[model samples]
Target: MADEETKAELREQFTEAFEGADYPVSNPMDLVPALPDGPGTRFEAGDVSFTAMELSTKLSDIQDFPYDDVETLVDDLIVGLDEKDML
Candidate 1:
C-alpha cells in the first residue's frame, strides 16, 4: 500500500493533469484531449505508476460518467483507487 504522502502526491498529480480536461465529460475519452500525453499520460508515485488508460480500466466500474469538474472525478477516483488498493 502507498503511504499517505505518496497518495497525496499522486492525487495532486491527478488533479493537475485532469484539471485541463474539458468539463462535463461524458466518457473517459473526453479527458484525452487534456492529457499531456493523451491516453499515455502517466501518473507515478512511490513504487506505483499508471497510464491514463490503465487507470481508466482499473476504475471503470466506480467512475460515474458526465463529470462536471475535476474534483468530483478525482474524489471518485481516489475512492476507487483506495478500494482497489491501487493507492
Candidate 2:
C-alpha cells in the first residue's frame, strides 16, 4: 500500500499527465471516423483509470483542460486505491 505522501505525489503526476497529454479534441461526430472500431481512450495513472469521453465532457464544462472534476475524480480514485491497499 502506498503511504499518504506517495499518494499525493501520484495524484500530482496524474494531474500533470492529464494537463500535458495531447488528445485529439474534435467533434464527437468527426471523431467517429477517426477512431477505429473498439478503440478507446483509456488511460491509467497509478491505480486510476480514465476514459476520454468523461474527461472531454468535464474538460469542456470546466473550461480548464485537465482540472476541475478530473482532478477531484483523480483524488478520490487515488484515495480509494490507497484505502484498498491497491496502490
Whole-model lDDT per candidate:
0.91, 0.46
lDDT of 1 by residue, 1-87 (tens): 779888888889989999998898999999999999999999998988899999999999999999999999988988899899987
What is candidate 2's lDDT per residue for 1-87, written digit by digit as tens? 655666676677545544332343233333323333312555444455555454444344333223334465456546555555546
Model 2 poorest ten-residue lDDT run:
30-39
TM-score of each: 0.94, 0.39
Provide the lDDT at 78 for model 1.
Answer: 81
Model 1 stretches astray by more than 4 angstroms: none
Best by TM-score: 1
Candidate 2 runs further than 4 Å off: 20-68
Candidate closest to the true structure, highest lDDT: 1
lDDT of 1: 0.91
Error (Å) of candidate 2 at residue 77 is 1.7
